[model samples]
Target: MSHTEKEATLYRMSTAEHQCPYGLKTKHLLKSNGYTVDDQLLTSREETDRFKEKQNVQTTPQVYINDKRIGGYEEVRKHLGKPLPDPDEKSYQPVIALFAMTALLAIAASWLAFGSFLSIQTVEWFISFSMVVLALLKLQDVEAFSTMFLNYDLLAKKWVPYGKIYPFAEGLAGLLMAAEFASVISIPVAFFIGSIGAVSVFKAVYIDKRELKCACVGGSGNVPLGFISLTENIMMVAMAVWMFISMF
Candidate 1:
């Protein structure tokens, strides 16, 4: 496409950004490309979440090229053939929301059940520690667990298969986490800290388009992988981290 045609083809960009340093570049990009922008500039609770859900955007400075989802700022710069801009520093609003919501839920439950956060914390430590140990063992013992003459659905046929079991291993970790958390546990703090590492792995897996099975509580049967899994894992990690930090 000719430069003018390319420029003409570019439509108004929809962006979700705060009044931050990075947001300035987004504004500059829009102006340079001759595209109008509608930055409603979300700050309050309702608007922020509505903006996020509407765009299905988990990160800041989300750019839609010609109404198609491109990505956040870096992706936009890459597409434009401009030297990729510094990775736009994004707000941790989503992470903060997860933490706040969990705390609120725990506090509400505690009030109704035990009349204090103290009881929740005490029981939570024991349960969390137990789960962490159990999850560790399950991961280390996967071969023995996966075998034992597996059958799909009670057809009484023995099947032995070898497949990478990391998803299940992660799921077991998540499950044990849930079990530990069921006491309305003191917010999954350790899970949160571990989540910092897990998020990187999760992102790599997503970029590679690897199918990951859900080993979380209950089941996620046939669900296409996406942000929810990452979010859940992060929440679990956050709880784990919080608990651990509180201990020190």
Candidate 2:
């Protein structure tokens, strides 16, 4: 076919009650890729079912190219060489988003408190906010986080309960640090956990040369354990030390 003759036929459900989003996406993709679409709508429930039965297909948003069945949304994407994302793929998106959001929040918080967008307190807020958010992510599935934590955490390996308690401890330290209250308690807690975590991550990723998923983002995430994971632990350690010195 000529460049201007690229043609596609789409059969998608667009009933009065329900509209399929994937159908819209497929249509948009076809148009963006310079295809002329012969849009066919299965307007009612009965009509959709009959169309599926006649076509011998189970799903909506079916695509046809040159009268040959190109399949549904996902299959059409594959035919166009644009496959869907794999959730289990190892990526740093979760951690990157977390740090970026916390940094912005810190700046906003500093502005609210000290009447400036950037300040020493902004750095403190960033660390505390990150700790709280990270702890919250782990708290989503404590059992899962604990299971993963035991893989590299020395304390968790030694005392199994520590795996479970780590999230709560981290959160408490963060809250106390943010409030600038009970330095005696928060300082020590942060320092102890941070120190242990830094050592454990160093041993696992650098010394032992192990490849593992990081629980730093969440139990279910697939972000690889590496320098970024090490950086998180180092940040915690530095924050704790900074808090201690500032207090004295």
Candidate 3:
């Protein structure tokens, strides 16, 4: 019996140059879960390679209970009933978090600026702040954002460069709108881009029925293009129109 029910044998790489983070995590997890861990360290590259060959396994951080092999970090987590994250899983969590954060920011701004939390100004601030944040996400990795944006954006597909310029334009419009500065420039800019975006989103999702990732929350994420994407564009257009109408 190599291991008891409450004992686990963990094989991991521990060298001068590098230590496996997953291996450490597995060891910690085993200890935390009331399991006694027998940590077997592979101190060198050759030793690690030899262990892999001997075990007929490709990776380290292997766990065993009652002499039964339990694979790597992810598999160990499964045995411990604490599964790791699945990267390919499609989720609305990112967008939901963004909206929730922006909503709180909006209310906070309203309280700070007007000593109130609920007002037409609050709504405006929410939209403007969202624009700024959304643009900031895109600006984080413009190349990645552009690569995703071109997948469905009508204008981006035609012009190619519009994808790269979009983040700056959105940010500028948002700042100007938020400050109520340069309305002459801001309103038109917002309306133009917003309208184009709305139409493109509508056509792609509704007309073409092509399910693609939205570049709204930046390209690195897996936010599916749909209702929220449409709403974002519509809000910008509405904000621009409202500002324009108010000028009269």
Question: Which one is best on lDDT?
Answer: 3
Model 2: per-residue Cα lDDT over 191-216, one tens digit each: 89988998999999999999999888
TM-score of each prediction? 0.28, 0.90, 0.83
**Per-residue accuracy of model 1 over 40-102 as CA lDDT, tens digit each:** 455555665676778677755565545576666677677777784233333334334444555
Alpha carbon lDDT at 71, candidate 3: 91
Ranking of all candidate structures by their TM-score, best first? 2, 3, 1
User: Could you give the C-alpha RMSD of every candidate to the true structure, in order shown?
Assistant: 15.6, 2.1, 3.2
Cα lDDT of candidate 3 equals: 0.92
**Each model's total of backbone clashes:** 18, 0, 0
TM-score (C-alpha, index-matched) for candidate 1: 0.28
The CA lDDT of each predicted structure is 0.46, 0.91, 0.92
Candidate 3, which segments miss by more than 4 Å at Cα? Answer: 1-3, 13-19, 28-56, 80-84
lDDT, candidate 3, 61-158, per-residue tens: 89988899999988988987896788867678887888789889999989998999999888888889989999999999999999999998999999
For model 2, the superposed segments whose C-alpha errors exceed 4 Å read 1-5, 15-18, 43-45
